[model samples]
Target: MEHSDEWTFADCFHAQKELYRAIISAAVSIRWMIEHDFEVPTDADLRQMEAEVNRELCDAWVEIYVLALREWLDGQ
Candidate 1:
């Protein structure tokens, strides 16, 4: 399959969807931690959570891109 750097509308839309999902999931996880933990999260803990969410967002974007590429190839 030929690879193109261009992105389609559907690709952007799906990426946005995945990003929103990741954000929501991160928010829920943070809330859970805040509610269940005996002490407030330390600065290091917050930093770790931030890093994890960033990784999750990056993974989601990559997954969306791969899926879009596969669909484009199938349509070819």
Candidate 2:
């Protein structure tokens, strides 16, 4: 006797769901930045502000790249 299983479909579905979520979240952050361009800090605050900007830019870029990759993967 043999037992049958159906896990591949489930696995692919989960992966697609996560990919969609990541893409949406990345897009949202980019929009948020564009919509709200407030001032940064000065003096000591300037250093901290610069650091924060760099971090946010890096994160946003990573997300954009990931979403692009996912789109490419879906195509292939």
TM-score of each: 0.43, 0.40
What's model 1's TM-score?
Answer: 0.43
Global CA lDDT computed for model 1: 0.69
| Backbone clashes in model 1 | 0
Q: How far off is residue 61 in model 1, in Å? A: 0.3
Score residue 62 of candidate 2 by CA lDDT: 54
Q: Which tens-of-lDDT digit does each residue in 1-76 have in candidate 1?
A: 8987776758665866666677757785777587868467788877777777767666577666766667666655
Worst 10 residues of 1 by lDDT: 11-20
Score residue 45 of candidate 2 by CA lDDT.
51
- Per-residue lDDT tens digits for candidate 2, residues 18-58, read 56556655654455456556434346654544555556555
